[model samples]
Target: MSTSPVHLWGPVRRAENDGVRLAFDALTEGAGGEPLLLVTGLGANRYWVPDGLCLALAQQGFAVARYDQRDSGESTRLPPVATGNPISALFGRRGAAYTAEDMADDAAAVLDALGWGSAHLLGVSLGGAIAQRVALRHPDRVRTLTTMAAVPADVSGLATLRYIRVGTLAKFARLRFPDTADGAVAAGIAVSRLLASPSRPFDENAARADALRNLDNGLHDRQAQSRQIGAQWSGPRIDAITRPSLVLHGQDDPLIKPTAARAIAARIPGARLRLLPEVGHELPARAWDTIADELRTLAA
Candidate 1:
């Protein structure tokens, strides 16, 4: 995973994974800090996640780098693994273009680009699954593991049903954001309202602005996301991860049940599980401080 300096919009960090080019942004101001890689989930763009959250994590004596995984955000969009809808790719109906292991290797390449030998890894949902793979395949490159909204390799039908509610399932299946800026804003607001914490007020304007920026900067490809969803898994490797770990889940997560978090905690040796009350699929501002504190202790 070697990197060459590239300038796309600014000083965008770029790396290659299995013939795919990837882009990323770094929070490197913290001197002598450990590298903390933030992995976004599914079709999510790294920029969509507020920089303030990354900064807050950086302030905890770690250098943070959040990146667009291949196929999402500004990263390279490889050729389609299949011929049809991205969702079909998730099931390998056509034949997968890549597997989850390929994506996991991509994360390790980020550390290589930063010239860091090892770093703490954190991920959300699908990103969390990739992080677990990174710890298993490249153990020397991972210092600690933290996951939010992630489930175990072998998921239960009950856990999967949480997201199958009529409204949630319908909205998720028909997710669409237009290319225009206005369209982006509207889509962002809708997505925010859908994915945001129910206990917290929906910040429509904030979501709009974030969506606009993401649309302007990151590339959204349904095929890319679907291929990732459909990617092949190596095995049940979470139990093989030896690093100190933390598993954070929203008690009220509508997409994935809290039981998934406990299942994950049970597999990894010494992994701590913290289920936040009033939290949803997305981590609200209130939980960020608490999560940061937990990460700090994990490093300690």
Candidate 2:
């Protein structure tokens, strides 16, 4: 069996400003649908969204573009951040080389590279925050905005939202990324089971496969995640987003309280909210259709 990751995503490409400055990996696929950009959450890995979800969106007439953000997945790594201790990063004390605004700029650059004047932007968790920034900064590039399990600003300030789950953070801190591929799969299974919706059964085998794919790419840097978290927490309120918007949250989300979704809906003028029963922070395979249907309605 081949461990190579490139085969999964055929015809990988990179988009950037002049001379590979701020360059990142992206793919534009699907047909007969409007242009849509799917932004990944904190991990910022396009692969994390699951191939099935992307394909479903594409099948629903969305010309979907998926990509990785800086210091994440296969994208460019900016200056490094501390990792061994993982405590400073836990508090988001680590300085980041870039901000969520910077990441949003990368998304706009991606649109320019793909020759798209604008596209519907759908983001999950941290990616939702980035999408909001993209709409605020480059209004012309976003046709519609849909955010899932995301907060309007930093995780701490929002009384209804949570900044971080300390217990989960401690769990990750204790985990050591094993050297063997099977070890990586096992590790991923363990984490997925923990993050899966309490109302549903987690598919350990599928989680293992996805984890193995991500592991083949590289380990996520905790410091980089800290910087992203910092930028997200430090944002000016997203009251200026005038784009037609949809905010979806799992009624049973543990990581991000459902109240956070309500807070975000209240902040963005003319935003619609949908609460999925028994859904959690992670998007279960079964929930993809409901999400896609909402996107279709939003697009219309």
Candidate 3:
């Protein structure tokens, strides 16, 4: 069997959003295919998205790009404010830094920087929520929307908790490591292992390599994660999204429940929902091609 082209990631580029600078990188320089932006999960750097998935999508005729959201990775970090705990912040009414609308605008800014009029957006975890907001806030700039292992954008407070596995979140507090580059790698591996599917063998080697390569992984920043989760959305609901939408969630996802995806797909008119069995919060290498194929069909 012929293998897919290995996507060579371009150097990190900057996209200015207001005063904040968002960091992003394209799959390669000259693919000239459909633009597809991959939004990373909460506090995750662009490297969290597997290169294998990007390669698979590239083979399917997508010019893939991934970006670090505000307060994550190389993106501009706002001054820290008092955010008790990230878990509490997830249920908080006010954001310590910015609104979710501002976060959505950041995606538009990246698109403007790339000079793409509109592009398909594929987001996972917290990124999925941001992608939905982007579609609602900047409908004209999105061709299609895909969310993986995400909750409904409209739900918040106690309502949001219904879709989350509280026990899994508690594990974040238990993660203990020295505050250093090596610690970041260790934390990354712990988080990755925690989110990996129970049915599959966790790839600690690959995770270690990725963590070492992207030493700026923001897994240790609880307050930043707080600000990210605490950012409230005042815009139209996910049902207001008019673009083509797909909601994919892992059947065995230990973070957000598959019901969250179902809720999203049900709310967004004509949105397709796919619950991958034996999968988890993290994207396993085995499911890369299947996801890419689904995205290809969505773009078509």
Pick the TM-score winner: 3
Predicted candidate 2 versus true structure: per-residue lDDT over 1-300, tens digit per residue? 112355444465677743233333333346446888888777446766766666667767787777777766667766665532434543545465556667788888888876789999999987888898888888889999999988774344323225445576567556655557766566567656656788877677777667766663333345556656655335556788889999998876666677778888998999999999878777777788889889989999
Task: Estimate the TM-score of every prediction.
Answer: 0.87, 0.85, 0.95
How much does candidate 2 score in TM-score? 0.85
RMSD versus native structure for model 1: 4.4
What digit string (tens of lDDT, one per residue) describes model 1 on residues 1-300? 011122211367798887888788776456358889888887777765555566567679888787888878788876765544644544345446776778888998887887889999889988888888888888889899998888774342244444334466456668776667766566656766787667777777766656655563222345666666667776565787898889999887777777779888999999999998878778666777788888999999
Report the C-alpha lDDT of model 3 over 1-300, residue by residue, as the tens digit.
012244477778899988999999888843699999998899888877887788889999999888999999899988776874688887764455999999999999999998899999999999999999999999999999999999998788888888988899889767767779999889888888888888887778977876777675478787688889889889898888999999999998988888899899999999999888779998887789999999999999
lDDT of each: 0.73, 0.70, 0.87
Top lDDT prediction, candidate number:
3
**Which segments of candidate 2 are over 4 A away from where they belong?**
1-10, 17-29, 82-92, 154-166, 179-183, 216-220, 232-236
lDDT accuracy of residue 205 in candidate 2? 73
RMSD of each predicted structure: 4.4, 3.6, 2.8
Clashes of 1: 1
Could you tell me which residue pairs clash in candidate 2? 33-61, 154-233
